[model samples]
Target: MLLSFRGAQHLRSWPYFYYRQKSHFDSAILLSNPRNLSQFSRAQPISARAMSTGRGALIVFEGGDRCGKTTQTQLLVQSLQSMGLKAELWRFPDRTTPTGKMIDSYLSSRSEVDDAAIHLLFSANRWEKRAAMLRALREGTTLVVDRYSYSGVAFTASKGIPSLSISWCKAPEEGLPAPDLLLYLELGAEDAAARGGFGSERYETLDMQQAVRRQFESLRDGSWTVVDAARPRDAVHEEVKAHAVEAVRRCAEGLEPLRALWSREPLA
Candidate 1:
């Protein structure tokens, strides 16, 4: 179902946007990326011309493995671009990067790292991309991302590590851009496993996936819209498209400053 514009506005004001004071770690990590430093050094006040053109919204897709996040993100980006909106598709553990290579090795079982260490690496991978992400939104390019911070937190926390509690996992993720809309593709574990190429990934086991799903549930707030992915692909796409279109319209009307991830008091 289409989310009305008023509904979208209400979702935007959800408790997730409540600002939190950045911790020392948050400040240090944000400055670790040289691109971020450069951008800050060159930043200027928004000109009248720039303010006239609104920024793009950050739209994220999150789900357990084999839940069709990749498929849906591509479809949504294509739809938005076809309608002449500036849109791009991005995914995490972006194994192409230097940090991502380490994450890829661990995920592929080619190497081993401590659970906490790997979790930090996943967060670092996203930090590396922060400057570019901010620039794109400010330049009016909507980002349709697959498996963002929610996946990172949910997957690692699912490990049930004593030290890696939900709050611990969320710590490193703070200060990253928050999604304007979070579309979660919900599917049964058995159904997801039945889909092709499920077992190939490291976290595809049924037990692990079940735990991850629970973590996702805990992370859900007003910003999330759950899409039943078991439905036909076209039907699922229509709902995603509707929400995305409304989000884009909301952004164009007057772009809100990008909020930090998990920066606010979550809904009770």
Candidate 2:
């Protein structure tokens, strides 16, 4: 059944239904279909106090370089916070940490490292912050990450590094949090390149971006929501906001514990 954003909000008042984490931020809200709710020994309305014991949603923005992930990530965070939801913005290869510093150097061409090593470093950058990431989610703070393992594995694997296969690149990130909704800012290489051109980062080339796009395509499944990012900024934000609001609704029943990236099944 189609669930509206308001329908999810009303779940709190409707006492008959409750939600449980099916996996990660993906909660199985037993709304409209209450037959299977027998598993939940008790049915409690999902109020703020109830949410405090659970976690928040993990929303990720992924796309090729110059696809406006950073901008959209920030804007979505603002929107969520405006709605009184606890939301924060995070970026991968966070240049602030020690491992991130190395990743920054690698991206800026200031340092040279083996392909496999650098790929691991990028994954490590996320690992170092995994605890805090989990804490934020568990404490009812939604995380709007600018990038994630998808970018790491996609970008590195796009480079055709013989040793750094997709599976190998994903090994380090196996136990990290998985995004409940992966919004892929859909934009073609040429369109993305047209936007202020490419940056000086290592993977800013058109060829690399195309290959990364291919990788992203290969990684997509039901978890992904492709939004056409080639539209005007405001237009894109509208669509993103819609998706973000819906995600908050679906997860409003309270978040699930963070799970490993593609841990339950192999990533296609």
Candidate 3:
């Protein structure tokens, strides 16, 4: 099932887009990377309705660039599918949507946007699809989102622009779906640079990534699980799978209704 949506304007005004377009990825698309996903060869019957309320877990993977989040997200999704679990992968700056197109232009340096404006655009990219996302979750499909509100706050607040305070950056994202488990694929900025170096995008530089890392660190609390991203892919997969399974169980066992980011009670 193609997860991408169209007509951002229509998606905003109509809630039907959420219920009408519910779909999942085909096995071929889910298991294309045998090298990484081939490790899981057995299928266990883990129901899509893992949560007590029959909703799927919202698992988010966050980290600096070059931390292998994309690869890991794919592998984890494959693993879940291999076990007969209903799982899907979603990424931010979905790039396919209209608002996402604007974000893409700014990230690739094709166009310039004010910092605050671009930040909200990123949030809007997610907002336009909230209903669709909620449908999947409520229908018992675990969502492994590539990036979430953390990235919004981290990258934008990293700029240190006085007007674009962390609070301001986080405000727009308050009502988005909160993750059941927030995993930070922890990697140092220097190590990330050594992996393959930065990309040509706006915040892909070492300096910017370093600053983003600091912002991510500040948001760390009990809800976050800091994984050692430097570990071998298989090793990291092992760790991610364990945490994901537990998080799924938690969500299935009856989680509270989704709330705003950072609005839950403070961490001890």
Candidate whose lDDT is highest: 1
Clashing pairs in 3: 50-252, 51-252, 52-252
Candidate 3 residue-wise lDDT, 1-268, digit = tens: 1223354433343322111113442222122223333232222223333432466888999999999999999999998777656899999979999999889989889999988899999999999889898889888889999998889999999999999998898899876777888889999899988876477678888899999999998988888998999988977887787678667756665644555567764211
Model 1: pairs clashing at backbone N, Cα or C within 3 Å: none
| Candidate 1 residue lDDT tens string, 1-268 | 1112234334334322111123211000112223223222322222223324878889999998998888889998887776556899999978999999999998888899989999999999999999999999888889999989999999999998888999999999888888989999999888899999998868889999999999999999887999999987876776787677667656755645667788753211
Q: lDDT of each structure?
A: 0.76, 0.74, 0.76
Error of 1 at 237 (Å): 0.3
Measured on C-alpha atoms, candidate 3 has an lDDT of 0.76
Against the hidden reference, what TM-scores do the models get?
A: 0.79, 0.79, 0.79
Tally clashing residue pairs in candidate 3.
3
Clashing pairs in 2: none
